[model samples]
Target chain A: MPKEKAITAEMLTKRFGDFIAVNAISFEVDKGEIFGFLGANGAGKTTAMRMFCGLSLPSSGKATVAGLDIYKDNEAIKQRIGYMSQKFSLYEDLTVKENIRFYGGIYGKSDTYIKKETEILLHQLELEAQANTLVGALPLGWKQKLAFSVAIFHQPDIVFLDEPTGGVDPVTRREFWNMIYEAAAKGITVFVTTHYLDEAEYCDRVSIMVDGVIAALDTPAALKKQYHASGMDEVFQQLARGAKRQDN
Target chain B: MKQFLSFVKKEFLHILRDKRTLFILLGMPIVQIIIFGFALTNEVKNEGIAVLDLAKDQSSGELIRQMDASRYFELRAYLQNEQQIEKTFLKGQIKLAVVIPPGFDHQLRHTNKAQLQLIADASDPNLANTMVNYAGSIVQQFQSTIFPQQQAAYQIQTELRMLYNPQLKGAYNFVPGVMAMVLLLVCTMMTAITIVKEKESGTMEIMLVSPLVPFSITLAKAVPYLLLSIVNIISILLLSVYVLDVPIRGSVLLLIGMSILFTMVSLSLGLLISARSSSQQTAMFISLVGMFLPTVMFSGFMFPIENMPKPLQVISNIVPAKWYYIIVKSVMIKGVGFNAIWKEALILAGMCTFFLAMAIRNFKIRLA
Candidate 1:
């Protein structure tokens, strides 16, 4: 049997009054694949992700998320995907368990499911002792990890992480990436955007976006070989240096 | 519905955990009621007045006694000379000085005319005006009683009776004002700030990505404040009735029904503000300066809308609080029923629909 395509886009373009925020871009991600969307600031990475997440509309494009048409089934797309941004999404005022239950509840999980998952999540994260503690009292790394856990708690078909590891220490970023790996291992497609090029090496396949268009798309090793670079960072710099847009 | 309930539960948690928000939500109405009820009253009573009796006669003495006996004035000082009147006023001891001109009992019996002058301190113009009016009325009453049988030709005795508020109590005027203010503040400001706070914390993006529709998300955010404002209305009405001694003359059901309608208006206004504002500070600023100020200025509670300029009078019609204030005053003070206030209530309902539609429309535009 052929592998399922979790997301597919063709000729996707978004314009904001004469400025092409997202130029025509085509891509595909298989089910359970970790796809890294890399770009410089203002390269339209966020606009593209927003379209896929049903947060925005494309001026003209063809796209589907989780096998649902983006234009006709925008709402259905939202149902099957989860999103976490750079800023922490969990309520700091709520306890760790309350935060988990609230998110699970909004996702239409049954009370029994939320209860069972709350226990399982607490034990998995080794936060059983601090389950009743307010999320504000938790350290930054723990908050980021918990945010990621809540995002995937609904068992979404794909989880979109936008700069999820921004501002974290290297060790915490590694731990966060481990969680992403675990989610992918469970057959959840991971669609992530990142500023750190080194993190691109962890993805199953990567696409470099420059000036609202994809300049390269391949595994990190293949991109390095094609650009004659030593690492993913050199590969990204080689493609990004040709961009015409100013820093945003 | 389960999703919405969970969302509202989360909102309640946010509100309950934040001590400051809880304090403001629960404390503001009671504080405003007390402050407006007792301290910021417009009713004047027992004002100090000096009597300069130049005529030492039975008529003069009788008139003097009557003026002092009336609850409107307190005879504080007896002045000997005209100069003493100015000195007494300068000392801030008297608001008005009554001058009974030198005359014998012969002036009333022979001439049937006597002169009386009321000198009032005009420093505080409103107080001076009221004091002068009170003293003038007392003199007229004395004149009518002294010569009841000898009726002057073409004399017109005008009887003035203040209806609804016969005692002219200031509480009757401000109780409704306080209610409008408290409900609008708690509903509009709190709703706007709470929604914008989600935007600030980055949770709004996550929420938009969820299976839950935007309408349900916005409604869930407003539901808690909607319930909170009803509690506010009940507390305000109870305080006005029991502690402040302002009567709820009309049907209690009508009052509550109209108040909930006004709360809906305010909540919709809050939704509109939240849709436009991206930050909590911006939402607060708009709610206070843009919304609260207009509620005070044009609501006909703090300021008389009839006395305003024509342009402002036109603008006042658009403020939902103005209609709410009118309905409350008519229903609570005048003891009027739904028949009397249906027009104002209709206007409020229309405003609620308009604002809610605008808010929902703006929210949809944002997604595009």
Candidate 2:
């Protein structure tokens, strides 16, 4: 039997008055797959992800997140999916443990479940000593890791990360990917959007978007071979060079 | 319900963790109550005055003693000559000088007429008016006692009685105004800043994407401030009653109910501001300029609304603090019950509903 599809978008389009931010984009991600959504500036990557997370309404077309319809079941879709943005959503004034408890509480998780999961998560992150410290006082790398842990603490089916590794050092970025791989191994699909071409090579399959449309979609190695390029970087440059929209 | 409680707890923690903001939030009511109650008052008492009694007779001594006995005036100096009156006023210690002419008892017993000159410093017109009025009343009283049945026919003796606040205490006026000002500052400005800070920090997006609805999130943010405002109201009432000697003449329960209603209106305004503002500074600016200034200017606390221009008088009707000030004065000073203030209460409830509806609509359109 074929694997279950975690997300399926058939010609999803979003328009902002006279401007088309996401124009009839089609894509699919299987369960437990690491999907890379690569795009240049102003290529509508965030706009498309917002629709999947049920934070924005689509102008036309159909999409389902975790087998729930985006239109009729927006709230239900939210329950089955988790989201973390580049903005760092955790409260800086709240202690690390308090942040976990707050996110868990909002998801309607019972106290016992949160208490048990919090200890295990804290131990795993090696942040047991800093559990009572304010999230603001922690280093940037630790804060990012803690934020990712909190995002998936409710055990959602899929997690959407928007530029989660934007300003981190290379070593920390590698460590962050290790955490992402661990989550993917547990059957939680990862749908991440980034502009870092090197990060595209770590994904199971990659899709490059240009001018509100996906230009190419395939495995990273297959995309390089098909474009007759040396690496994913060259392939991205070749696809993005033809774009009329300059980086905003 | 548990989720809502957890969210409210987090809000309280946020308030308590910031030491500077926490100090400001809790300290503002106490400081304002003390300042407005004792230091800033309009009731004039113990003002110094100089007596220029040229008569030097028994009648002059009697009148001078009467003026000095009254609480409004203190006999500070006894001027020796007519030139000393100008010198006394120029020194600024004497606010008024009473001049009893030499005609003395001869004119009063024979002609049944007497004249006295009251020279007052008009630099502060309001204070001068009040002092003159008090002095006139005292003289009239002395005259009535002296000529009990010797009044001429058809002398229309107007019997004046000051109802409610006979003494015209300034505490009775400003205590209620202070309540309105403090509640608006605490409930509106703090609530707006708290909500907008989340937006600036990006937690608002995460909140919208959560399973919890936007309505609960907004309500949770307001709940902590609602409780804090109640605490503020209690502190202000305590200070006014025990320290300032301003009593709650009406039912205490009724006064608190109306205060909570006003608090809800203020909180709804905060919600409206937060929904429209994208940054913390913008929220603070809007709250201060849009809400706080109107509360101070139009509430008729610092300035009389009737004295304002025709257009401004009409605009004062829209300010929620004006209605609240009226309600508080009625309940706290006049000792009236709900029957007297139902209209103002209904207006506040309507404003609360209107602001809350607008805020929810804007939140949906902007965030969703």
Among these predictions, the greatest lDDT belongs to: 2
lDDT of 2 by residue, B250-315 (tens): 998999999999999999999999989888889989999999899999999989999999999999
Q: What is the per-residue lDDT of model 1 for residues A84-197, given as tens digits with 9 covering 90 to 100?
A: 976789999999999998999899999999999889889988999999999999998899899999999999999999989888899999999999999999999999999899
lDDT of 2 by residue, A64-178 (tens): 8888788998889788889998798899999999999999999889999999999999999999999999999999999999999999999999999999998889999899999
Superposed by TM-score, candidate 1 places the C-alpha of residue B169 at a distance from the truth, in angstroms, of 1.1
Could you give candidate 1's per-residue lDDT for residues B53-105 as a string of tens digits?
A: 99989999998899889998889999999889889988988888888888846
TM-score of A-chain in each prediction?
Answer: 0.97, 0.97
Clashing pairs in 1: none
- What would you estimate as the lDDT of candidate 1? 0.90
Q: For candidate 2, give the DockQ.
A: 0.64
TM-score of chain B of each: 0.92, 0.93
Query: How well does candidate 1 match the true structure in TM-score terms?
Result: 0.94
Recovered native contacts, candidate 2:
0.77
